[model samples]
Target: MASSAQPYHFGFKKSKNGELPSIAQEGFMNILQKNGSIFLGDAGQKELYLTFDNGYENGYTAKVLDVLKAKKVPAAFFVTGHFVRDQPELLRRMNDEGHIIGNHSWSHPDMTSLTPEQIRTELDKVREASARITGQQKMSFVRPPRGIFSSRVLETCKQLGYTNVFWSAAYRDWETDRQQGAGYAYQQVMSQLHPGAVILLHSVSKDNAEALSSIIDDARKQGYTFKSLDELKVKMYR
Candidate 1:
């Protein structure tokens, strides 16, 4: 399968009234799921699969890890080649602490814009780099940079042995200088809290690091549990 001129970009549309956004959306998630990718989890359970996208270490990941450790919540950390090469200790700690290490691609390129060979190169580089520390550890998840993809792009991922993971809830937390304060961050996440949500938080956000502990505590108070991607039984096609 080959791609078209347009790439399938994953746009997160938060539902009003605090409800889970319909999975019926056509291109972004529906196509990915049909092609064996994962966006959410355990539709029947009130669980949130916690994931972090780490393109670079912004001096907040360690603290974020501390909060997750203290809260006893497991998470998935997806990293690019830069993060993997620069933050080996943090990656090791994540693996040692039982958090799932995922591939965010080597250089963080738009998969839909690349050929299958290029996409494989991006993911394979990160995979090999990560395996050195995560020895024999399986890196099964790949969150495409910019949350972009296409049917052909997703097929390429499956062919390269990855299950593309997208998110159901996220904010503009990746922009470091424009952080919307801790209170606003907390409210953004809390208001979108839904069953089977894949909450994508950037590990580099100071606000996220500040609000994580409370987020977990409050989510538990509201009867939502966090689950690692490892616990889910997903079908990854080749």
Candidate 2:
């Protein structure tokens, strides 16, 4: 999108002469510009955007798909080249079922640590694979691996015609052993949810698959409808 009309504002540490410290000024500006709010369409409308990352063919994806299909809900799936190549059918199913498929980089490297060329390669590899499998060029959304991104990464995504999507809400269900439980994860997600909240879940989590439908149900009960990132016309901060 559109750039947010909201003015950039932040608290800053001042120097002895009352001027802002250089580092603090830069940090504050970055925060203010990068921290745009996620809008879920109209005001007073409770909408939740569900997104999944690092999808591989664990067969749990199918179960997750089943639940979404049953509920007539759509979600966004960020896939790597490896997953797309290994599970072409599942990728196809995701596309065919009307879910948004997004790039999550080829090897899920920490983009901030990679060279600009390496980052481009990571994005290009995933874009090429996703296009090959889905016959669609120009995937418009991406989430950095581990939610790590630099200014260079964000600029790279913009140059590649992809929007960098990050979540407003997430939990520790990515770790299989540390997942607390499905019910608890579900409760954590739903409880913290708000309008325009992008809830990040991992497709690889067994607890997540178990909690998926219930989370959707409970979010609905609380009057939050779900939307894909593509459907959300959020103002870009940078």
Candidate 3:
């Protein structure tokens, strides 16, 4: 379970209105012309976006939080419903600390494999839950489980007012048991970071938890500033 301070570890809860914010039809059309994914942030500057997936009641999240707090940096956490139901306080803490909480679906299912209705149901459950917990209905970002998405899934998310996010850089760290060490993980992440890079990591990995501070430190030395997904003003497409 997630701690009460960071409920984002779980999936979204319902919002009061049961709907997402509306996007400009013209802008949406422009987005469709480019690609299926959203342009989350301006690539003009050397900015980095740090996002974590599938967090639970691990003590590591606290360590990660300590590092972020020390640096006064913000991040995004895309959570599952199971994490939310178990750790409401952690979600609250995330919101309190100015971190963006995104939906990773209720059960982290592969949207590409499910029907449109099923996908909607899965997303909706999380949205409603998130809204209920946070008292806000502005969750507009989602990252499909395992990065698997389809046209139907994309369209459904757009209709529901969510921009699907995908990472530009990631490495093998999801495996908790055979996890890579911090030094190696740091090398993997640092070597790939670039302008507008969205780095994906998992909170449950010991290597990731250990490597996060160093990764941020190295990136900072290279003149990179971390931005939360919301700060990017991502333009949704497709």
Candidate 4:
């Protein structure tokens, strides 16, 4: 089934007053369901999925990996073609250390604006490039660049054998120069804790790198288990 070309920027109301964040307002949930995409897991279970967008190396991913390793957490790193080309060792290490390497598109363009074939090229290039280095032949998950997508983009991803992964929790941690310190990052993440949350973080943020260890530790203390994307089971909410 084909859908409209209209683009949607992914977003949701942040959880507050001890509530799960809602993506219900904009038909985000509906579209995701229609396109076989996923933004949340089973809300009945206290499981959290950690994912990072690594468009380029800002010199913090190694530290992020270190923290994940030290804490025994498995996270997914959605990388762009540039990241694969520039940081082969990091990619290899991520795979070796038991992390899923995902696709964030080749040029990090708005996939909604590209044709299906163009979209395929963008995704294939990253997958092939990544496989060569990481030796993990199957790159199955994709997060669109800048959280922008449409029905067409989602369908293209499915046709190309990818599951589009959106997030249920995120904050403005992408602005590298305006970092508000690790405590602020910690607070932003901690406040949004809920069952089946897909947390999106940018590896370039120094705040995320600094706060990640605490985030994992405290979440576990609260009884939230961090699971790999492979273990994720999509749950549809109406």
Candidate 5:
């Protein structure tokens, strides 16, 4: 189907000068939220929203969930249709244990390249499947696969009744074999910490899973509290 939507790619920009929650970043974030999407939370708070992009299972999500549970920190797990189908138990546990199950698209396609109807198809497939598993028909948040997005896709999702949630803090944690030392992982995460940061983690990384507890602990030690994505405030409309 043809779509009359305008595309706007959300580039992944990292300013690692230890002076983040940058003003420019905040401005961009403000624009998106004003227009019905969000990349960061309210720039006024020292809060972190923990989110995981789960395209598929790599056997470490359970452990990651365990950490979140033990630490009592709520997180959002953005999943694909394959993830919901392949790991129903895990998906159910995430829901049962109070984590937000976000729609990450049915097949994890590059949504910016898809027309509105195609995007709806991708989102609805997961939406219905997720509701079947979680009993929540409305999945409030969606993260475009690989961080690919456009206003067209964002608005499409918003029309589909979801608020787009993007991340402000992430690292090269998706590569399973090229894993960094826990210290390195710790620094990568901790160094990038800032107020209203939306920290993204991949469930497939063992290092991310291992360093998670300490990350949360140290972040708390640094006076930052973790919140689920739903807890964060958004403008929802311009």
Candidate 6:
């Protein structure tokens, strides 16, 4: 594999009317496919994967967990070292409730700029800390900070025994201060709903916390089943 130091920002054309989103960068898509990374699941199936980036505590993860528990939905939470240190109890709750704990690096740095060994250290620190807290010895999934990655970054992670998980559906919900409302979050997510969407949400968003239950309900009403990333069946685009 070629070690291209260039960073690729993950983005896709928003899906509408249940259409599959398209990635604009062919080279980046190739890198993802070659590395066995995934941003979507089987497009032919009406299944959605929910994941959250927990970079820090925003006082809403508990609510999120509550909703997931009530709705019986499984989600993956990618946590950074800061999150692991700051919210051990929350990590334990997530683990205890049968959710997937994924690595989001130690310091949440642009991993494309780091050396392979440096990346290993960053990921290892998070995994080790999380394992101590959650008693899960293996952390198999990773999402690069800020959706930025390179072939070298992905390759390094692959060699380290991780699957890079990206997102096929997302919105600007991370800006907590600018939260529109729960309705806004619901609209943004529902409008982009499609089969095989790997929806990326931020646990810091109050709107997401409020709208999550409704999102799950409406997605289910639309005949879409919620699935964990572990059950994902990859479908590559041309």
lDDT of each: 0.82, 0.71, 0.71, 0.90, 0.80, 0.93
Backbone N/Cα/C clashes per model: 0, 0, 29, 0, 0, 0
Per-residue accuracy of model 5 over 28-110 as CA lDDT, tens digit each: 44446544676667666778889998988999999999999999999999999999999989988999999998989998888
Q: Provide TM-scores for the models.
A: 0.92, 0.81, 0.80, 0.97, 0.89, 0.97
Runs in model 6 deviating more than 4 A are 1-3
Question: For residues 87-147, what per-residue lDDT tens digits would candidate 4 score against the true structure?
Answer: 9999999999999999999999988899999999999999999989977888999999999
Better candidate by TM-score, 1 or 6: 6
Q: Rank the candidates by TM-score, best first.
A: 6, 4, 1, 5, 2, 3
The model with the greatest lDDT is 6
Question: Lowest-lDDT window of 10 residues in candidate 6?
Answer: 229-238
lDDT of 6 by residue, 106-165 (tens): 999999889999999999999999999888999989999999999899999999999999
Q: Which stretches of candidate 1 lie over 4 Å from their true place?
A: 1-5, 23-30, 234-238
The residue pairs found clashing in candidate 5 are none
**Stretches > 4 Å off in candidate 3:** 1-36, 39-41, 233-238
Question: What TM-score does candidate 4 reach?
Answer: 0.97
Model 5: per-residue Cα lDDT at residue 114: 87
Which regions of candidate 4 are displaced past 4 Å? 1-3
- Per-residue lDDT tens digits of candidate 2, residues 1-238? 2232222222222222211122234332353235332312232346678888865666589999999999999999999877988998888899999999988889888776777688789989988888888888878888778765556667667777777776656676777667677888787776667666667788888888888889888878877788777778754221
Candidate RMSDs in Å, in order, are 2.8, 8.4, 11.1, 1.5, 3.4, 1.4
Clashes of 5: 0
Q: Candidate 1's error at 75, in angstroms?
A: 0.3
lDDT of each residue in 1-238, candidate 1, tens digit only: 4344368667755744557665454444547666678876665678888999999999999999999999899999999999999999998999999998898999988777888888888888898898897784567888889877778788888877788888778888999988877898899889888778888999888899999999999999988888888786642211
